[model samples]
Target: MAGFGWATHSAHKHSANRHHLRTKARMDAGFRQMNGNLERKGSLTSSYLEEPLNKTGVVSCIFSLKQEVGALVKALRLFEEKGINLTHIESRPSRNNKEEYEFFISVDQLSSKALDEVVDGLRTQISGQVHELSRNKQKDTVPWFPNDIQDLDRFANQILSYGSELDADHPGFTDPVYRARRKEFADIAYNYRHAQVIPRVEYTAEEKYCGYREDNIPQLEDISHYLQTCTGFRLRPVAGLLSSRDFLAGLAFRVFHSTQYIRHSSKPMYTPEPDICHELLGHVPLFADPSFAQFSQEIGLASLGAPDEFIEKLATVYWFTVEFGLCKEGNEVKAYGAGLLSSFGELQYCLTDKPKLLPFEPEKTCQQKYPITEFQPVYYVAESFEDAKEKVRKFASIIPRPFSVRYNAYTQRIEVLDNTQQLKNLADSISGEISILCTALRKME
Candidate 1:
């Protein structure tokens, strides 16, 4: 599905209230002294010093201080002396040592050299061990990936809520009643649990103007149960649009993160983002079909550890296939994509010759671009859901991950077949299942 808005939102920011007692001259002297010492040690490189101040990114580091009365203050003073901005800070008792306290600090706008200096200072002066927390593409630094279905809870607050704080161009931006209604929906999603039944929405008549039946706003749990039975796909409420990585990761576990809020009542047929109408009326039916479900999961699985460029490609493929796709039914082309199905006007326009229609090939579809603020000018037509699934499976084989992963439903975990022992375990498990099937067949014979 197209994202609400493709803006990156960082939940962490520098607090304005944080104060430093060190003067500018003192901090500058400290910075120069630290740089000179590091240079003498061959640790601080000249290239790092040439980088612009604005080029810095957020970096988190953890260190533990001795139980001395002023140990925490002394460690913090190291940052103040170097003029580094501490965006966030937290403290907890060290698990390994009761007398020590572990401190986690997120530093904002610090260059690589500056961070290294801070780490060195912390280790040499106040703390013996200092480690930098990282989220990068390296094997050792790759961000955490969800292994089980319940792991999705961590991403609940990780999304950008376009509905809660409406953009100026959004239809409900100035409507007090509409904003309040949206907040009500946002609260439901915020408090939702993994396995709990979804609360039924009593959508107003205006909210039902999207051409769905008056009583068609079924509870998410009902749709989730139906999808589970048909294709093992289930639904979970989301505050708003998740990052492409998080959204596709959910699909890997056969879970769909759906928005609980509906579009502004003033513009029922047109919405700037995905709402309950788009999710249920447009997307739910296809998810119930086994072939399409498999097709969807193929895209999701390929996204694991994928590069940013490839993620954009995968998202585009999702946009063309799952969101605004069309398929042949007998001799007529029918609307199957959620975007087209949800919007009454777009639904009618896409089936007509108003938009360009092309065969749904993953290679071409991934490269095709579409506008988000307006109706899609191009749509991909699939021969059938089964055909789409087979093509996607072939396409997924080429994704550049060094290891392959499979979901173990029995254990509710993703098993990475990167080691010999893991492969052997998987092989033995499969062999036992095959043996059981053989016994049943022999008994029947």
Candidate 2:
């Protein structure tokens, strides 16, 4: 709620390696037990939060969403039939509670049998839902049309198109007034390697978002400066991630590449598009964390290689976890999911009872669709950080993992999509360099 004053795991300078020293000592004793690590607020509690515990075999799935009762019930049955255990759930109102939305959900503590069946079954069920679904990640292993490489290139071209369209007036962005603001825009994207956009509005100057955002600051005219001033982010690799964009045209400077965004005190749910206030405070800390930093860099790099569908799916994954995911330790749930951590409302709701919790399975998560407007009806939880990291790591691979597919298409289309141009170009590019790379990479076998 305030500026640069909150404590963070990034500031966790106690030498986590000592954790291993203690772990080895425990191992020499006899049995190795690890209580999941948890550090929650007022009401949250976990055995691990109080002490260290070990797990012989535990699987955690990560997820989030927004929808109604019937939709959730259908999702529930799919997990139920597979013997999957539902562990945690929380919900928030839609953007405006826009659509009679349900709660956000989470599930954890699953068995191998539950893993195999639930994954297989939910993969089938999630796609079947009338909504779009996204799991943390699971590749087809068979080599789909695209990989992370493709997503990188696809967005490159898009940014290029957007960038080229920018008038001399707007160097980094293409909007009218900023048309004259282009040079100022490109400098930040290039210097800080923080080239992202957010729509800038004159009247909402003090509001959280004006569309394109970066570093979570409202009117983030310069991303590089924001990184330096806020969290001391130098963007060595983050800078590299920017140049990888091969798209010829310049991307609109309006794209709000952020570390912070504003939060509405009166609101009750988290919005995926961050305001300057939220981004700077919530995201920058994680970026400063070594594991999280490297992981995000790899993800961005991997995105350069992924396909369109994969990229879109990845966005959902990011939304659910890095942006708005939650985790459970012992019986208490804490906010590890960025969306929850950054959001005041979801910060509370994700740990509360408005939504249903489900065991996280890549297959099922990929098949489930969620609304961005309000609180989620379901959340996928992991017993530990490994549950969260391993899945994301797998997504960067070249092999195909399972993907979500639907048997029926929803007739109610609130959104209009013109797949003609973007898809065609994207499809072509995927089949072009990405397809060849996947094929060659797989040939190593």
Please name the candidate that would achieve the greatest lDDT relative to the true structure.
Answer: 1
Which residue pairs overlap in candidate 1's backbone? none
Residue 33 displacement (Å), model 2: 53
Best by TM-score: 1
Pick out the ten consecutive residues of candidate 2 with the lowest summed lDDT.
247-256
Q: What are the TM-scores, per candidate, against the unseen true structure?
A: 0.66, 0.37
lDDT for predicted candidate 1 compared with the true structure: 0.65
lDDT of 2 at 69: 50
Residue 262 of model 1 has an lDDT of 70
Computed on alpha carbons, the lDDT of every model, listed in order, comes to 0.65, 0.37
lDDT value, candidate 2, whole model = 0.37
